[model samples]
Target: MIADLFPHAQPGAGLIGGVMIGLAAAIMLLGLGRIAGVSGLAARATGIAGSGAPHGIAIAFILGLPLGACIVASVTDWKPATYSAPLMLVAAGLIVGFGTRLGSGCTSGHGVCGLSRLSWRSVVATGLFMASGFATVAVMRIAGAL
Candidate 1:
């Protein structure tokens, strides 16, 4: 099973991955009384919220994402493969924001916590999320955009 996941699996990578995820979720829930739904947090930061945590903390978490990636790269041999230009990245962010509003939650909510709770809506939302991602990748590849 582990071999199926990574042909060149590094020792303790799976354990480290699971620990990181658990720590993130636990910290979010414990400190904020909210799920670490990245999309919801992003929306709130961009003025789409009624009330929430101090904007600074949310912004910090958002900013820390890239910082954390850089830190990992510093410690390991990892680097970002490729990404869109600034304008395209902005457009993608807007589209993602809109989609999260339409979908009522992000992957962390629907695909992680809600699904764990056996929520039917979550099940459907997760399915749609996966399908849409697959479709997007396929369409982009077909158009030579990937």
Candidate 2:
């Protein structure tokens, strides 16, 4: 196991992950003046237009996520797992969209970008998002719907 292989490790993976994400956010903010907010991009992509910066960067970011996954799969002998069903996936998407709108931003926005700026609204939203997620998972596990 990965954990077993690095028993004396100092969370290098998490550190690298945070550094990479910070670099991405910094690059986006400095180079494009964008907030790296996913909800803003999703809104623009769906024709809700508030800021065009998030729209463009969000488009690139969203598209690149799957592309990166594919690249990893191709190079690392990773076999992707299939989802339960197309309808379930669609329902999940709708629910997530609703949650994003209600929460004012997605996790990437509120949790990462917003929290980085020490925004109170973002902190509340992130807390709510996380709590809701935890509740959902716990309920689903209890109901055997997980």
Candidate 3:
């Protein structure tokens, strides 16, 4: 279905994206002494949480996410996957927001930045993250939602 929708799918795009994410995380860590976690950064930007970096920086980082995506989409003939309903999208966002808070960090922080530093907490968190994601997909598949 996806390939039918976007025949120009380039598998190398994932590798490129991963490398770009790693580099961005590295830069944030080394330059600002901060973890490049979207959830934490967004929270700080929205004044929901406190962090070492200034709110302005957090806001910039948050804004950059969509800006970067737009730039990529413009350059590459990449099309985003569409979903069925807006309400379901909002519900999914709320669930992800809750999960990020409950987990104490998002995937970028734990899976990418934390694991890179060899943190035990990050390892466990990443494992749980993957497992939960797999379980969610399995459940969704069984429910004929995927």
Candidate 4:
């Protein structure tokens, strides 16, 4: 489906990205005893979370997200993906922030870390996340909005 949409199926890039993510998560766990959850890190970075990783670390991690992308794009033929209008982007971000709070963590936390650790809660949460994503896409497609 992605190839259908973009025609550029970069499996090597996916592998590289997956390996990098796993390394980052592993480093956070083994070196810092923290789960590499972007949502929690974001909250911590913004002082919304009262307690968690150090503020500096959170800020660095959050900043590294886009910075890393920029670095890669500089070296490789990587083009930043664009979504919708600014208003829609902001609204989607707010909704995702709320959903991350409601769901207890983002995909990185529950889907990768929690699932790897055999957490039943994460399993359920990830399942619901996938289902909701599918449903949303289905609805959007039906409405000719996808």
Candidate 2 achieves a global lDDT of: 0.78
Model 2: residues >4 Å from true position, as ranges? 1-15, 50-58
- Per-residue lDDT over 27-130 for candidate 2, one digit per residue giving the tens place of the 0 to 100 score: 77888877777767767766675656545566787677678668867887667686867897898899988878767788778888889999999999988889
Residue 58 lDDT, candidate 1, scale 0-100: 70
**What lDDT score belongs to each candidate, Candidate 1 first?**
0.80, 0.78, 0.88, 0.91
Off by over 4 Å in 4: 1-8
The candidate that wins on TM-score is: 4
Q: What is residue 142's positional error in candidate 1, in angstroms?
A: 3.3
Q: Write the per-residue lDDT of candidate 4 for residues 1-146, one digit (tens) a residue.
A: 77777777877778989989989899989988999999999999999989888999999999999998788889988776878889978988999999997787989999999999999999999999999999988998999987
* Predicted candidate 2, C-alpha RMSD: 3.8
Model 3 regions more than 4 Å off = 1-11
Off by over 4 Å in 1: 1-15, 54-57, 85-90
In model 4, the clashing pairs are none
- Score every model by TM-score: 0.73, 0.77, 0.87, 0.89
Per-residue CA lDDT of model 1 for 1-146, tens digit only, reads 87888779865877897678667877877877777777777766777775665687778777877888788889997767887899989988888878887887888878776776688999999998899899998999999988
lDDT leaderboard ranking: 4, 3, 1, 2
All models, RMSD in angstroms: 3.2, 3.8, 3.8, 2.6
